[model samples]
Target: MKNSNIKNIIFDLGDVILNIDVPVASLSFAKLSGREQAEILTLFKENDLFRQFETGLLDEASFRNLIRKLVDSPDWTDEMIDTAWNSLLLDMPVERVELLKTLRSKYRLFLLSNTSSIHITQVNKILEAATGIKNLDELFDKVYLSYEMGIMKPDPEIYLQVLKEQNIKAEETLFLDDNSDNIKSAAKLGIDTILVQKPVTILEYLKDYAV
Candidate 1:
């Protein structure tokens, strides 16, 4: 059964709805650069380039250029870079799509993801292929992308902006994300949250509501 007090639901894209493997992408990049996967993963953690790209501080071309420099592969093409970067995005399960469709009928649904333009494009393609949905906009009442909004999650400003724009109360909203930091931030704002961790997807977590 749905939470009676919750009128809105905000969903995180990666790991929550869309399946992603960060190490898979790192491995792909590593193969291309002849570096160990651990080295690539460490680079991702230590560098702010990804955060900059997610927040729209870097354009696609500039982001690609920076990636080339980081991997020390100046000859890598845009297609190659995008392919390696996009390897993390796996698939959107059809059942998750069905769950969203069912929930949409009863609540205001929203997509709030910290992602770049490149990932969004590929995700939409994945969505289209899986469920014939044109885009995530069709699944959610509103979509707040980090690249479009100039803000990222775990930041109070981003959560506040969504609440302000949607005219929704924090206490009446439910947020689901795979990241504990993100769940903590939302909880601090008085929004109910579920940390969608391994062995328990949003589908499994909200099975009663789906029923």
Candidate 2:
């Protein structure tokens, strides 16, 4: 069922490759300030914490410190913040990495993610330190991050930018994202897409391609 017409494989980096553990951070905040997860998330999100953090309106240190304060716990330590921020990191599967290495020769690979500079640094360090998958940088022809690009997924403009930059037709590009809304947005732009889900990784889903 694979479409041979697809020439470009656009990947969503987080959750697709690097696992994201949002609840860990959310729960940590809740526990630190003695609040419920729902309440903590509401205040954190309502205050535009992620947007500001991504846009560099607030630096990493300041962002963490501020969020801790909002949780009403000014006494929280740096370790607490780091632990909360990083609690969601999961191992990158070697099998998937090898699969990508094989796919590199056949199709152009690109990485698109809604990420901030701080999170990327942490992820890079964690990934390289543990797995030594050094070629991740070389495998992808382009790596686009929302914080750096000023546009995030689920936004048509970001998808437009990718097709424009690559000079490729949307139909010829297969975008893989863990976020359903992002897939829907790209689908609207005429791009082929796969909404990655639980128990199904990009590699497992694409294995039948027999490429």
Candidate with best TM-score: 1
The root-mean-square deviation over C-alpha atoms between each candidate and the true structure, in angstroms, is: 1.3, 2.0
Residue range 1-211, candidate 1, lDDT tens digits: 4577988999999999999997788899999999999998788778887899999999999999988888889999999999998999999999999999998998899999999999999999999999999799999999999999998999999999999999999999999999999999999999999999987788888776666
- Shift of residue 49 alpha carbon in model 2, Å: 1.3
Residue 42 local lDDT, model 2 = 92
Per-residue error (Å), model 1, residue 185: 0.5
- Clash count, one per candidate: 0, 0
Model 2, 1-211: lDDT tens per residue?
5988988889987778877776887887777677899998899888988777765677778887787678777787877877777776666666667777788888888988887776777777766765685535765888887887776788899999988998989989999998899999999999999988978887777886536
lDDT (C-alpha, whole model) for all candidates: 0.92, 0.80
Query: For residue 207, what is the lDDT in candidate 2?
Result: 82
lDDT of 2: 0.80
- Candidate 2 Cα misplacement greater than 4 A, ranges: 75-79, 134-136
| TM-score for each model | 0.96, 0.89
